[model samples]
Target: MERTERFCRIEMLIRSRGCVSFADLMTELGVSRATLKRDLDHLRTRMDAAIVYDRDRNGYRFAVTGRQARRPGPPEASGVWFSEREIHALLTMHQLLDGLGVGSSMGRHLQPVLERLQGMLGTSDSEARELVRRLRVVPPARKPVRGRSFERLAGAVLERRRLRLTIEADDGSGERDRIISPLRMIHDGGIWLLDAWCHESEALCRIPVPQVRAVQTLELRAREVPMRVIEAELDAMPALRAA
Candidate 1:
């Protein structure tokens, strides 16, 4: 198994058992003693695991307030810690993805990554939901969008694919079809926009999500854009542009 998978298993084992012996971890994970020790060290130092070895108990466990005095393990090492504000930010993002319509392909693409972050934060979806309730985000001045329209744009962006988008026009004008190589998906001022290379225009453009009436992802492979170009375009956006 991969290192990340091993890390998840280790966390589950220790959390479920309250304490776990190195020998037990080796047996369960089928990893050598050195690897197990390194994993434990990494978890405690990098991931904010409240863990310590207990000499008398001959195992590792989460540190408790009074238990530390009697257990007598090594001093907890200092490392990066997640602040409450950071957690709140993560939870807010969790809320955004969770609110997407069910069975969305883009949501599926993101689930694994989101799950790992949730595990690292030691938070559940229910907890995130409660947090979302407490801190509300009211979108301002955004036109309502059809659910399917949002899904198509998101799926295309996540998959790094081109899309055939039907752009609607005003003054009773008919819609026009354009094939775009999606570079990024962004939200601003309560509206969703896609930064893409338009085949019709032969230039980079930002398409408003609400104005997209229909979308279809092409089977053809997506054209790759350079990292420098994407970064330059992102920096040139109105929000990031220097006055």
Candidate 2:
């Protein structure tokens, strides 16, 4: 993994696990003790990550109460924020987006906002343009079900609401009406899946959006579905199971 990826992973680990010992970090990262110590020092000095020694825990911990002081602020607001490595990572993401063919649309719509970000880093427009050209990103394939239907189903799933769906055959033969409680939306192998709970079956199901002919929101509330059960069903799917 790249240094930036490692740093991001370390930050996430700290946030999720609270205090982390040197030995623990070494074990998790498979890095030498000296390397882990250097990374810790780099985070403290460059990223403003507050790592304090906890004698009782026998590890390094981020003091939650004083976190604000240690966290780097927005660049323009606080010129002292973000080290060179952080800036490089940010630029890399922009470059990746550019390479993905979405950059033209993003430049037309989101470039203005990104201009402010560039200003914070003291990077000129020409420099940003150059960076975009030099870096490349390959985006994954587009999924089925574009436009309004996709948006509606996504919203319903996010809000944890029930949806009245009509699944129609491609041959225009039959339709099935279902009241489904949306659980999760998964994008896999260039396909979008709405993992939901079918009230009629009292079981979890995966609905491909393209097969859904019509979708409408229902006043009926969503019911809690066990994540493990839903995951098991998903794993049992022929395509996923084959993989």
Candidate 3:
């Protein structure tokens, strides 16, 4: 990757991970320690972002509230706002969920905002209801997992890093620390699966999120695994295929 791309990625990683160590950044970006350190210095000094070390965690993170402060704010209304088509699509999705009788916490939060958006567009409540009633989404049956861990796992995958997790089976007989390079998250058979590369097995694995006892991000970086190859491998897995 180019230096510029590396720098941009480092910045995004810091934002996503809340704080990253020189070693972690180097591993993730496939750059030298010196280069990663320089990038960190640039962010701290030039960008006026507070990046600090945590003794307990032995990692770098934002000084303010660590990872919590990195959460994105609400979208601003000005400049290249969502088009009418996009708004309609969003409403349609919400309606489909309503039809499925699946109440989402996110949807609950978005309801008021969606209503306000419709009002701004001068769309009547009956019309919005009708649109939602017409739209349908056949969501696969998947057991709900802890939302927070799912979010963290997503961050790890996007940053191309490894994760250390304790997985427990449904019968409550299995628990082990797994080092996985997460590729994507999928909901199937009413459970969320973290499609990943199991470092111990040196092969692809799909771990149920609900069965995950605890999650810890690893310092080891993820190798570039093609999505198509991962999908093909996943398709061949009897467990995944059945699910």
The TM-score values for the models, in the order shown, are 0.50, 0.47, 0.52
lDDT digits (tens) for residues 112-167 of candidate 2: 55654554444557986776566666557754473456667867877878989888
Arranged by lDDT with the best first, the candidates are: 1, 2, 3
Candidate 1: segments with Cα more than 4 A from true spot: 1-89, 96-130, 170-172, 230-243
Model 1 poorest ten-residue lDDT run: 74-83
Lowest-sum lDDT 10-residue window in model 2: 73-82
Q: Pick the candidate with the highest lDDT.
A: 1
Query: lDDT for every model?
Result: 0.68, 0.67, 0.66
Choose 1 or 3, whichever is better by TM-score.
3
Tell me which of candidates 1 and 2 scores higher on lDDT.
1
C-alpha lDDT of candidate 2 relative to the true structure: 0.67
Write the residue-wise lDDT of candidate 1 on 56-107 in tens digits.
8898877776555566554333223344456567657656644432224356
Number of backbone clashes in candidate 2: 0
Q: In candidate 2, which residue pairs get closer than 3 Å at backbone N, Cα or C atoms, i.e. clash?
A: none
Residue 233 lDDT (model 1): 75
